[model samples]
Target: MRIFVCIKQVPDTETKIKLMPDGSGIDEGGVKWIMNPYDEFAVEEALKLKQTAGDATVTVISVGPKKRVADALRTAMAMGADDGIVIDCENSLDSFTTAKALAAAIKKEPACDFVFSGKLAIDDNAGSVSQYLAEFLEIPHVTVVSGFEASSGKYVVTREVEGGTKEIFELTGPAVVAANKGLNTPRYASLPGIMKAKKKPLSELNLSDLGLSSSDAKVSFTNFELPPEKPPVKFIDGDPAAQAKELVRLLKDEAKVL
Candidate 1:
């Protein structure tokens, strides 16, 4: 079996974020970067699948600035990925363009049974890459997957849905899987694993290497801004009936939910 897992390097959640001088992106200076937390689940799931099959190969792939992505690939490899591939993007790409670049790299492989990725990257929180990748690959994709079972070329997966519902799906190989939290506990890289990962075969790629150009990008980032501060809560204090009436009035007049 040939499995491909996509990951991203994102700012550590606790790190304070600041905007760039041009307001087009984040200010990375003094900020710590790590493999996206959600993608860790995806990588762990891929490794588990490979272990279950006993003869499968897992390839870890990502697209980002080369300097930032190198450590991410090394971390994935240390977690037991068989190989690693990094795509050097000249500029940060939106989800669609990123997925396009990833899809092109996956196509370069001889054959792939599965492609797995995190449901969302924490930095942008845009949980759309797997859907776009599936579209580009023209395969079935199950997102927010929390459960999975595989035998032969068939797969059974449970996807988390709104209102605490879990939707089960059955799909065949050559599909995409968007791993979510609770899928599996990610393992830490052991000393030996880290040493071995340092020697693993890693391939670096560029847009030109994939026969892609900047013109292929369909979206652009014009500016970035922090979210507005949340308003303070207001209380309706009065007798029971008066409070109820005031609550209704507030909802209708101020909250606009009526």
Candidate 2:
């Protein structure tokens, strides 16, 4: 089986990021970077699938500044992805534009049996890339999947839903799936594995290298804004019953949700 997984480098979840002065982007000064947490699940799932299919080849692909993305690829390689593809795009566009670039690179590779990605990147939280790729490739797509099993030439997946419900989906080859947190625990790269990754093939390509250009995709972020800061929190001191009543009253009056 040949599986291609998309990964992303995002601001470290714990970092306090600031917006750029122009208000159109983030201020990259002190913000640290890490592999998108959700993508870790995608990597783990791919590694697990590779384990089941001993001859499988798991390739990790990302689009970003080459220097910045090596850390992200190293994260996947530590967890056992066999090779990496770093699409050397300026990445000045949003997620949809990035996906189009990724699709172009994916087309350059041998047709993959399955394509997978994290549910979404934490930074932008635009959970549309995998679905868009599936649409572009004209293949099956499933998202927010918590569990999966492949057997008898088909894939059985459990999709998460509201109110603790799950939807099961069965699909065959040439499909896209989005992974969620509970699917697997990501493995940390060992010292030896990190060393091994240095020798692994990492293909770097630019837009021209893939015969793609920004004009081929259309998407834009008009502006960027942050949510308003919260008002100071208040504490109502009283016994349990009184506090419950006060809480309900506060929610209805202040928060405006009953």
Candidate 3:
């Protein structure tokens, strides 16, 4: 069995974010980059599945600018993936463009029985890459997969849904699955694994190599803004009845939500 895991490099969640002066994107000077948190779950799940199969191989793939993307691939390789591939995409790519490029890369590479990715990238949070990539590949796709079982050349998946329900799906080989947060605990890259990762094979490709164009971007970002600061909390002090009245008055008059 062969598995391909799609991963991403993103700003550390706790990193203080600042927009560029022209609002084109985030300022990179002081930013610290790390693998996408959800993608970590996907990688761990792939490794787990590979172990279950006993003879499966895992590969990691990613798209981003030059050095940072290579770093993300190294992280995956350190986590026990067999090999890595990075696509060079300097400019911003919308979900559609990214899916197209990834699909092309998968088609060019050796065949894979399964493709895995995170439910969403924390940076963009579009949460549509797996679906779009599956469409491009013409394969079955399942999202928010918290539990997966493979047998008899088919996979049974438990998908997380709204209202805390799980929808079960069974799919054949050559399918895409986006793992949810509770799928598995991600393994930390140890010192030995990190050193071995340095010697692992890594391949890099450009957009032209996939026959894709920047103009293929269906969505473009022109400006960015941080969310407005939250207002200070207010207190209503008085006897219980008086406080209730005051709260009602404030809600109706100031908040206008009564």
Q: How does each model score on lDDT? A: 0.90, 0.85, 0.90
lDDT of 2 by residue, 21-113 (tens): 778788888979899998999998888888887789999999888888888997788778899999876654466667777788888887688
Model 3 Cα shift for residue 223 (angstroms): 2.3
lDDT value for candidate 2?
A: 0.85
- Tens digit of per-residue lDDT, candidate 1, span 1-258: 899999999989999999998988888889899999989999999999998888899999999888889899999999999999999986657888888889999999898889999999998788888999999999999999999998887899999999989999999767889999999999999999999999999898898887877677776666898899988888779899999999999899988998
How close is each model in CA RMSD to the real structure?
A: 3.0, 1.9, 1.9
What are the runs in model 3 whose C-alpha is more than 4 Å off?
Answer: 236-249
What's model 1's TM-score? Answer: 0.87
- Estimate, for each residue in 144-206, the C-alpha lDDT of model 3 and write its tens digit: 989988876788999989999989998877899999999889999999999999999998888
What is the TM-score of candidate 3?
A: 0.93
TM-scores for all candidates? 0.87, 0.92, 0.93
Candidate 1: give the clashing pairs: none
Residue 138 error, candidate 2, Å: 1.9
After superposition, the stretches of candidate 2 with alpha carbons farther than 4 Å from their true spots are 215-217, 252-256
Question: Local error of candidate 1 at 104, Å?
Answer: 1.3
